[model samples]
Target: MIKIYSITVTTILLAVVSLISCSSEETSEKKQENLSTSPATANYAITPVDLRYVKLTDDFWLPVVKRVQEETIPYAIKKCEEEGRLHNFLIASGEMEGSVKGKMPFDDTDVYKIIEGASMTLISAPNPELEKELDRIITIIGKGQEDDGYLTTWRTINPKKPPAPWVNVVEGKRWESLTASHELYNAGHLYEAAYAHYKATGKTNFLNIAYKNADLIVKTFGDNEGQIAAVPGHQIIETGLIKLYALSGKEEYLKMARYFLDNRGRSEHHKLNDSYLSAAYSQDHLPVIEQDEVLGHAVRAMYMYAAMTDIAVLMKDADYENAVDKLWQNMVEKKIYLTGGLGARHEGEAFGDNYEL
Candidate 1:
């Protein structure tokens, strides 16, 4: 699976935020006292600085940012439009006729990711032209969304037929093949990108799409009656939901995120029938707090750790924090590659036994 390196991005974001403001010793002591009395009220240990407050003025990073603005963003947009990714969105909206037109089940995410990157660029330097282009993409994305808020172009285009042959076609119903369907994964990316756009532009156009889909998710899954009792085959949805919660301060979003995290490794929650995607492969063999070492797909493991860190700080959960601390130590001291790439071995694209790299 392709990983987005979210942990690295989040860490860098937090570091910049720290540089913008430094708390006094007395303020830190007061916060510590509050944590002891009411941890939930305590602020996140590290916070991401709003992009508006950051200006990329350094020589090295400034040119790189400018290149992405002048070259990379337009290039990626042109390629996506030329390659029929934009066409697929229209097809899903019934504006055109055909099956999905991509090799990967989650190909639509390429568009969403482009929008996210461009939106971030707009944050550092306001560009009306790029903002308009993003609006146009978001309009097409709105067309692709189902009335009920479903947005995966492939599955939305044709439920009975998947873009890739390996996807088990189970009556073409949504969520049937959690391990390969990638419906939830696509939604996760949409939510993430949409949130970024909202933060950058302060426009609700993209965010409304995210809100509708999130509401559907909140209604569809939980411990409540009539809700599905399963976790994502992929891990990033948990963090995506948490990001929404952080943005909107909605309890339902936070609860849904917690539901996904709390259910992992529990027998009653979702599990894959395939041996290859078995619990261990997805980091579902043991509860998050019980696992001390990383042992799954490298990106997925890091994404999950990122969520655990979010929960640890946002919710002030000690067990989750302790677990993440131990896991971080193991990765740094034992399994990490000399090149600094995660995943010590190629098999299963996961970590190997200690020092195996």
Candidate 2:
């Protein structure tokens, strides 16, 4: 059953990788001449074969994949509904009247991640029912957005009262407490799920929501006059923007992604004294290129590394590539556990210092 579950999840990831590669190929060909200069024009070293072309005929794997499609996806969605993940969206949308209905500030991502998983499943196994359900979920999610494209439901429901007590928001406005609030992290997952939904069904319902929020991000956070010049306390938004740039050929998305990575660990860009914004807690101890060790929240480190790698390949950046290489070497040589788990400390869900495991 575990093997089946792993394969099921692997197929979902394959869908994301394959679809992104497809966009990369198209974008690369059109801007072939600009490959030398355009950050969005370059391609990754490897591209996965599209799920549609690859048949899962192996007796063991095929059953697992089918089980995921037949059982897991539906079960997961039901759990999300039971957990109030869906209700939070309705509350933010004003379709329901209640406080945010989750314990975590980033509970919106539970719905987004499930949609992404379901959408990825749709790529290999087309299901009209699942697609329609996703559309309904997407509509609820869309209705949660503020007039200016902001869509963090907890904050939208009540900025002063975050869903999680640790979120540290005292009459917070948007982006006020970026580190603990997870405002951008919510946006990142939204973009990812939207892209997957668009890829699977070619529908604009979710994609449009992603685009509108991204446009607002581009306008809100920057080095320009009146814009907030700060990076996300958590990562992944960088890669999310890159995905959008791949689809829209929008330079702003690509640049914004680069901006987030470039400003990490730069104290002058934004003060980082919060408990969650520690120099290493979120991997903000050093600028991304200067980061040699893989210390921090494991998930955030991985996401940041992904964006770094994307920039390294896309922009042909030697510094970024070197840093990524060093971080990789450090992880494999000293940090990684025997079980292949990346994080060792459960307290922070972080990597331990050199063999601390």
Q: Per-prediction count of colliding residue pairs?
A: 0, 1
State the lDDT at 231 in candidate 2.
Answer: 88
Candidate 2 overall lDDT versus native: 0.79
**38-102: candidate 1 lDDT, tens digit per residue:** 22223554334444345555555556667899999999999998888999989999998987787
Instruction: Provide the global lDDT of candidate 1 against the true structure.
Output: 0.77
List the global CA lDDT of all models: 0.77, 0.79
Q: Which pairs in model 2 have colliding backbones?
A: 279-285
Error of 2 at 231 (Å): 1.0
Report the C-alpha lDDT of model 2 over 1-357, residue by residue, as the tens digit: 000010123546555544443323244444444433333433554443333343344455556657787898889889989999888888888889998787998889989998987876665566788888888888888888988999998888888888777777656888977888888999999998887788677889999999999999999998999999998988889889988987788989988999999998898998654655578889988888898899989999889987887778777788888888888889889998787778889988899989888
